[model samples]
Target: MPSSGSYAMVLDSTFSTERRACRFSRILIDGGSSINILYRDTMEKLGIKQGQLQPSRTVFHGIVPGLSCSPIGKVKIDVMFGDKNHFHREPIWFEVVDLDSPYHALLGRPALAKFMEVPHYAYLKMKMPGPKGIITIAGDYQKSLTCAAASSQLDESLFIAEEKRLLDRVVAMASKQSDMPTDPKSAETQGSFQAAKETKKIALDQADPKRFAVVGSHLDNR
Candidate 1:
């Protein structure tokens, strides 16, 4: 299971369906509720009117599903949600509710029940009660460390390539300094050649590391 940090998401408090975007720190996930809830203040900022709400219900608010969260007053636009690859580009439906205090929105069970069903480390304290049973969940940022594992290999490769390229540049510059003539014309030529060699080495480092390393290892290689 991924840690809470792995799934830690930041929501914009002042988001626009069209223009004038803003972000908020108040975002919560609630498995107990059936529908996602939005605060009146946020809705107003987005230029969404209460009249647009669809007839739906929870203890605090009514449902406005399928219509999409759009900014109507300023410009025609859509509010988007989700992560890099797995995101809901379609305007997500939100219900307008009169929130007393403490939260801007609640991500109800329906919005993230599936992902929650999987085992996960917690970042905060939360509870859930459903047809099967009731479960109390703890939240923590620990899972974020595991997420790093997913990209560890890629990071390692990039680091190695970068390191090798830098090392090759250092070596080439050192060699050029040692081999260059004191004569002005020949010194300029050597410096230019040295710069070109460094550029080629960096490019080769990105495309084919082994070849770059082999060539950098010998005079005949470049």
Candidate 2:
């Protein structure tokens, strides 16, 4: 059992995929999620080939409503957790999604249920039945906050880079048009393009960290 003070912590578990062992900083234990998620980049880092994944049609949503995401595919891999003496190993299904998330993988409800583990949020710990009776894993509170902050910063940077890329594409198109004979409706078309750019800017702003605070706070409070 955990005390009240422990609720401020986030539970993270260290596990290995089929190819390699993952760092603790890259694994998040998320009780709120119904499905386990493995980021595409992480899969690449582990040297897992795309051909290994099975086709999947699952779509996911963020903590914020209306923010939907589609996964690339699904894969089954061996996940090993707990310390050496009391470690547990199992084959788990993970939805592979191409997204920039702080954690490389998220262990969701399905994984927990499979292990028959009990998560104590207030203690920032997890326990499950083992051959020896019980196995426990503790969370790193500071690492959780650091991961959250870094993840947020990375998202902002990606957004800025994407916006710049779009603007560059528009400018290149305009430059190409300048070298050729302009159509009679060129001015109207340019105005419409400018309006579209403004709309993209607004969308970028709406994706700021404030919009994702709900999810961040939930992890922080776990």
Candidate models: Cα lDDT each: 0.48, 0.72
Best by lDDT: 2
Give me the runs in candidate 2 sitting further than 4 Å from their true place.
1-24, 63-66, 155-222
TM-score of 1: 0.35
What TM-score, computed on C-alpha atoms, does each candidate reach? 0.35, 0.64
* Native-referenced Cα lDDT, model 2: 0.72
Expressed as tens digits, the lDDT of each residue in 124-216 for candidate 2 is 778887777788877766666687787668767766877799999999999997886467577666553443232211122465744432222
lDDT of each residue in 1-222, candidate 1, tens digit only? 443334542232234565355554555555556766666777777666667656653344222211134222221224334333333323345666553324456566655554343323344444334344544444434433343343355456655766799999999999999875889888777673643343234235566766543233224433
In terms of lDDT, the poorest run of 10 residues in model 1 is 66-75
Against the hidden true structure, what lDDT does model 1 obtain?
0.48
- Clash count per candidate: 13, 0
